[model samples]
Target: MAYIRPLANGNFRADVRLKGITKNKTFSTEKLAQTWADSIERNIKAIPLMSSAQLLEITEADIESMGGEELFKQLGIDLFAIRHCAKLEAINALSKKELLQLTPQEIERMGGADLFIKAGKRIRYKTFREVCDEYLSRWGKKDYKGQMQRVDYWCQFFGDRIMTDIDIFDLREHVDDMIDAGDRATTINRKKAVLSSVYKFALSRGYVDENLVRSVVVDDDTKRRDRVLSDQERQRLIKACQVSHWDKLYLLVLMAMTTGARKGELMSLRWNDINFKDGTAFLGDTKNGTSRELYLALVVIAELKCHQEIGTGLIFPSLELPEQPMDFRAAWRNALKAANISDKDVLNTDGSVKLERFTFHCLRHGFCSALSDAGKEINQIAKLAGHKSIQTTMRYIHQGRDQKRQIVNELAQAFNL
Candidate 1:
């Protein structure tokens, strides 16, 4: 309701308030006090009246008639928004013929004229890290195993920086730093790909003008060709596994190497996901939530059958969590000790002998390599590996065993062996 009172100097003062404006703060409008009071009464009496703001929509003529801030003070409206209204009122006073003489910056300073900026335009200034977080928050549960792990990587790198503040030069520095550290082209490219995804998401949301990361070129030649283990290395790893203390660890390694399932998929498995009689395991929710069935290798089946227990649901239950698989690090360290391998030294599929810098994922690679050696088609290999595209599976097709053997035999034949 609004009320007008006579002030001490014969001036009129208006007091207006809106009910249900907020939990406590009341809305005030002395400039349209009379209209507001009538509207409040109409609202209380179940009658509709034109809104006070609509009725008092300021016009060019109204501004000159009202004159200045003193006229506003006389009306008893003291809000800061009135300053904006006055500023606009003054700008609208400009004659149309004289408006063209103003500079672009000067015209922009007239706030009312800038209202058309957001129309049909996307805002894109978010940082790579911010976009990554927003992406994860909205879609993390549906992301692939590789993507879920990269969250820590990005957060560690640039979580504190604002998205708008980052530019191509900043990305170039980060990429150069990675390259200088002897990181392989594949590793550097993967990080760059993540950045590209962030930009793509930002583009969709109108946060970026362009994907600057895509414009910069990465050294694609630095990709490491997949190198499979030699027959002797595979044999040694199998031999070491026979004497391993954690039998499940050996089984986990063997399953990964044979089936090419990712570490997370293997670790998340339960007895219910497997079928011993049919010799198959049904993965209910893969990277894309599509169920997939894998043929259990004879070797993997033998390991599972030998260690089968009736105590729990998890196929690979942890010592601590019981319902969960133990952290691979604990068993991985032990495996390394048994195989006499360091972090820099790669293990064969069975985890024996120091070959190179390959880690757990190399086991999956070993599986695809063996499959390719056995004459499996590229598409079949991709399906088995759970790759969305054959291009991803291509990296796993290491030089086959037959190919390597042929090379060795050719050398011997060339020497007249």
Candidate 2:
């Protein structure tokens, strides 16, 4: 029996079960999955009889699939192609798309034509390290390289073994060891996240039957930091930033407090993005692909104009490389120290540097919190913070991968009952 199941993300899965062997295929459309299901079930049943009618159906589908319907029509065998399949028994299990590429003679050998493509999953016999290396080769960015370091343990742990041989138990044990090692919850999560991406690629390429990444869970019990700056803290921080008015970090902190934008988005901004006339800051290249036009506070506009005259490109250009955005870490810490903000790299009993109460992202939380404290509606806060429901939208557009980024909803944006 074959049946169609709808996935949460509006995709569909077709499952075929017969003779105790079950195969499942996913499709973006229910119709496509159903068509696949129908075809697979029909082929499975019609194997021995291999009716002429079925062969005609297969040939016609192949002609269409090959995207040569017009060419087939010109040959006039468009209708007569099926009659030619006299002794055809097996098609080498060539998919319709593959069958279409074959020369009529080659296809005739399979359709009666011997285009010999070994049918079945071509197992690459890859090790976890090999798979991770292939996956890592796709990205050359420093951030990607940094993330690879976080999850590189997986390559070492699963070393020299077939990647698919790694079951959910192996992943679970690794995650458990990470938890036991006093690693931060975020660190553990990020390691698992990178591993998940590697496996998703494996699943797509038929290297694995399933993405075991879905079964791994984050069990770290650390409480999340929901640090929103108090009115006093905001005032002191503003004064500290003002002390060094010429510093770019002052402007960066002020912008984050006012806009509630992601740090990466703010860092990527150019002077052109902040429009004084329109009173809007256009955020292009957001983590989510959707761009937003943020309503800039007039005070922010006036402050930005102070630097616009001096700068030609990035509003926060790097000191050394005008092409890149500034990395504001040192300046941020200086301002925090001047403001007497308690969040510091403090020495713990274990003598390790443990982060304290607050960080730069807390400025963004403060922005949303201030809005909420002023009694703004929940949806309005979501709108101002650019946190509209984008989960399903991305899935619809990007399909299986790169669509499942779990953007954390800022605590301040959540409504309190």
The lDDT for every candidate, in the order shown, is: 0.66, 0.67
Residues 1-417, candidate 2, lDDT per residue (tens digit)?
A: 998999999999999886444667899999999888787666445443545575467665674443234533432333444553332324535455554444434433443222232233232356788888888887654567566785587777886766756778988888889889977777888777878888888787766768897898786532334455656878888888877634766677778888888898888887777767889888876765678987877778877877775344878878899888887676777777788887644668998655546777667666766665565665676777777673322211211122222222344346432
Model 1: per-residue lDDT, tens digit, 1-417? 556665565545555444422111123443454554455444433312334463257565654343333334334443234435656565657664444344334544665234213221122324457677777666645655567577558667766665555678888898888889998777888887877877787677655557888977886842364645567666666666666776677788788878899888888788777788988888876865677887898888988888776543788777788876777686676665566544464567888744556467778888898888877899999998899888888877887556889879989999999
- Clashing residue pairs in candidate 1 are 123-206, 123-207, 124-207, 124-208, 125-164, 125-207, 126-163, 127-163, 346-356
RMSD of candidate 2 to true structure, Å: 21.1
Clashes by residue pair, model 2: 108-113, 109-112, 109-113, 109-114, 110-113
Q: How many residue pairs clash in each candidate?
A: 9, 5
Candidate 1 residues lying further than 4 Å off, grouped into runs, are 1-141, 144-162, 177-188, 216-223, 310-312, 333-356, 400-417
Candidate 2 lDDT: 0.67
Which candidate has the highest lDDT of all? 2
Residue 307 of model 2 has an lDDT of: 73
